[model samples]
Target: MENATTLQLDPEANSNQTIDSQEKILTGDRATGSLHLGHFVGSLQQRVQLQYRYAQTILVADMQGLTDNGHNPQKISANILNVVADYLAVGIDPLKTTICLQSAIPALAELTMYYANLVSIARLERNPTVKNEIKSKSFGRSIPAGFLTYPISQAADITAFKATLVPVGEDQLPMLEQTNEIVRRLNHIAQQDILVECKPLLSKVSRLPSVDGKSKMSKSMGNTIMLSASEKEISKAIKAMYTDSSHLRVSDKGQVEGNVVFTYLDAFHQDQDYVANLKEQYTAGGLGDGSIKKILDECLQELLKPIRQSREKFIADPSQLIAILKEGTERSNDESNDVLAQVKKAFGLNLF
Candidate 1:
């Protein structure tokens, strides 16, 4: 695998910046739908590793989900437990990682409202992430105000935890900028620094392509194989996965680049010798798409089988699952309360 570009942070620019020796990390998924393999390879696996090293907090971002799914609030509620199950299934330890719901934390909402006033409408419009999402969702004229200003809410999520490290993909780089911008502005206005600036922890295996070789693998695109997909579902998705269209016959040369099967293998398969030999054969000819897809299917099933079993165990005990989230929500609220109080004091709103 090739090395990815490194992310840089500006520590000297803000003399008020302070970092805890044990760096705290805050990351999460939107409860808009069940997570898929893209989530696994991209962030879930990395979160599991970061738990042992940092004070980790995972959020089921239902409030953020409501930004786009405002008309369908039921969808967000329905998937909350599913997202929790997926997190535990993928080895996110409850003891080591705090798993909380965004809406359950009142401080987050309060912080967002305060931070929203710090950022201007023109600056929000210039945010690359917001612009890109607006275009992607085709919300041209009717873009939701919440969706446009999600970056501010996101800043609250990070700072409320005092998180110093945030795991993000390349596309989300601008979000970190927006967050730090708010922090800087607040510190400058109040004549005291209240919020801590965060740095981006770029994922090694960034974005995964859709099974149909589309730009990204997303549930909305109908191109994803869910993390909890059954053997039959996995088989169906693999059969439909896109391959080199120019490779007419088994004997014809094929292009490995942009091929979804090989992409999956690169991300999931561990055997270097086997993958190298297969790639050679695939490029030279004789190997077929069916054979490649079969290998990918088997690899995915093997990877997900244990995750599926773990998810089922948690799902079977719904009360225990809810209890876990409630516990985390309580812990997270306690942590954020201090930050919110400080913000209020800075703005002279703590007079009461």
Candidate 2:
């Protein structure tokens, strides 16, 4: 109902839709953090819609979790169920979408180890995300080995599922490129199309900035509004949101150029005409950030109400939720194993 989501356009939206292409997709989040508005607007929102349309697979990346936060294993483990809860809390149906725990599959680790050799230390060093995160986290001298090798691990995550399309933000373009490089090398060496080249499924709105006006919204930064938040919680969070550098006085003409509230409205609010009207009002010197935030809050509450209720329903019966996840994991393994077998044979690993 909120615009035509990826699910709407995906051919796997229904059983009746053609299953012609092996466009099996693998995408997911690191259970290292909470699900935020940024996650929804950027990836999960599209994913929820896309799953119905494509042969979609949603992975709970606990293995990737350990790569960086291996010491915080329990923290990562606790978030697993919470992350899945958030997934189902959205529209990611377990029956239609394969939701697997990444740590549960040993084949992925094996594949990752193999792909690791194909990449160069220089290539990994050039990865923008790795560089940024390492500097930000101040891991200059103490970088973990897994942290350095995450790009290869990501390639395994994508190829193990034989995902033809990988939904990533622009920041992740390098990672997708890395995965395709492996695919090319493997396919060429084997004299067969053992791996499929993946494309970046960048959404028109690629990412949501943090509410505090940082480059990206992050859980650790404390600038997020969770999809499962109550109306009161959402309102409180919006009221406390940071705005532009100027606009100190009530009557001072405010700039909507980087206002978090307006940004959120533009990304999440579907009433385009209303958004346009609000933008005009704010720019023309009549609208207050408070006024805009009020409407934004209402729109967000309407969006979150159903989701919160759905989350509550799922929480009421934990066993049913586990069963759904187990079913999805089983289905995912069946398909991923086929891709793994092909990769192993191409590398002559099956000779053993």
Candidate 3:
């Protein structure tokens, strides 16, 4: 079996791997914040494995952040490379994965403009994904045009590369449906197949809870373990972690349910017996939160030590990291342009 590092994406090549229905998978996250342990468990873990199994395109969604956070270009800019750092640290082998910046490509925006007219304005309002995001961001009354049309842009992102699989959590199934809607409409209107239908691959774990036991871990909540955090920083974050609410003392039996510590163990630690033993001790009493935290510290350190080291190395020579990003964006543009050309031809908007 060949390593993912040996695979390559050459846009100019004639004899490359087949671009079959199973060739590509596209997915990614926003770079508006630091990545956390939840990111590792829920998404990055799958990305590392899929690199070998499929042609993956990981888009750093910097442009999407601007829809609501338009005033904070600096915020998105600051975290762009940091997110790339996280991706590289998590072992997203650059050779197999096209780690692209969404904002760097104009072709995608063009595709979005073309598809936007194909769908009704009323249909855009009914898109479940866009509606949820609008509500979540409290944009009910004053939604940005870009915010309302994000699904169109997403369709552009996926169809521009002819992505076949988009790994999204269950909550994001609507976005996949919207993208397929555009694909169906575009093909039907053109009387030719200009795009491919994409299937959803929800995360195995779906989402991870925050250290504060929040249903979702987010950097905004400050209950996250930053991937680049040092050992002392990781320790500090773990010490501040929320524990069982009922167990006020070491002598009291602790409830494992809704306990962030145990949940962390479940998500990060695969040693079921060890976790079970710890849970039993915790449930019966005499197992202090400190003890459990110490166990978590050790486990997380083992997981993060290598990644932290890699991050430090990448951070030391950011120019080289930027070079990789530039190369990736350039390669992605070539592919995007090729697909865009086909789409324009389908619409009879191009000649010669």
Candidate 4:
């Protein structure tokens, strides 16, 4: 068995590495809402590039979406297909990358039930990601147990496929850390490597800030540009984006440090030199926020045009989307059930 250590992969350097066709990657999104530009920059784009090189599976985690929204179960159910559409729109080929619905996979829930025993409430509370989420959600004394233990659920999602690589953002590193802890503990109890430890394939791009610039781009906050955003919506979002508050006029010097427009340009604009030149002009007191916003608007409009069209086409044919999910979920069921059997045997629960 390999040493239990986390290996980080720089997405920029991924092309230079030798292709490992056998490597299995498991990455996905919560089925709470449609994906956005932040999703593209953070992980969806990487998934598109990786599917051709590795055996990848994207899990639409509806069960995880229920952690906090359990009171509103309809929200999760309504968006499962929307999330899958966004994945397809963003170029994650369903044939190359298996796209599975989480609720459909019974083994995952079974695995989560078993793995929950390996993790403790104190350790779950101490997790940095969970801590931040709890504070931000203001759950107060009403924290949901499912919400707190979703990391263990996440571990089940990863290990059931024996996924060796998981694409994640920096904020999610703690979740992976806790996953490895569970993997190691279970293996230790089994006295062998029945479950394989996974590594984090961190995104090279930083998390995109919300248009309001007060927080990270999030769907629940209504501060993000969705993948299926129309051209008019894109332009409107760029116009309202937070930029230098002090630059009241075109001739006034602008600060680019916290400007959301420049940040989007840096992430989306293909020409870095052009963005740098624009930044220089803005800081030197000549460029206007409108001019730069126009540039960003144009860039995003072109970028999202095809994605919007693709998403719309998929949405028009619900049967196709259902077929894709059904096929992928069936495949996932077989694989995850095999892993659950091994885990059950490890726990001496395979009495039958």
* Winner by TM-score: 4
Q: What is the C-alpha RMSD of each candidate to the true structure, in Å?
A: 5.5, 3.9, 5.9, 2.8
Compose the digit string of candidate 2's lDDT tens values, residues 166-196.
7766677788888889989888878999878
Clashing pairs in 4: none
Deviation (Å) of 6 in candidate 4: 11
Sort the candidates on TM-score, descending order. 4, 1, 3, 2
Pick out the ten consecutive residues of candidate 3 with the lowest summed lDDT. 1-10
Q: Write down the lDDT of every candidate, Cα atoms only.
A: 0.87, 0.79, 0.83, 0.89
The segments of candidate 4 whose C-alpha lies over 4 angstroms from its true place after superposition are: 1-19
TM-score of each: 0.93, 0.90, 0.91, 0.94
**Per-residue lDDT of model 4, residues 119-227, tens digit only:** 8899999999999999999986699989989999999999999998888767888888888898999899889998988887766677789999998687777788999
Task: List runs of model 2 lying over 4 Å from the truth.
Answer: 1-22, 248-250
Across 1-352, the per-residue lDDT of candidate 1 in tens digits comes to 1222343432232323342456789999989999999898888887777776667899999999999999999999999999999999999989989999999999999999999998898899898989999999899869999998899999999999988888888888889998988888878867887788888887656588898997678787879989888889889988988889998898999989988889889888868679778899999999999899889888989998999889889989989899999999999999999999988888889977
What is the lDDT, from 0 to 100, of the residue 352 in candidate 2? 59
Greater TM-score among 1 and 4 belongs to 4
Give the higher-TM-score candidate: 1 or 2: 1
- Model 4: lowest-lDDT 10 consecutive positions: 1-10
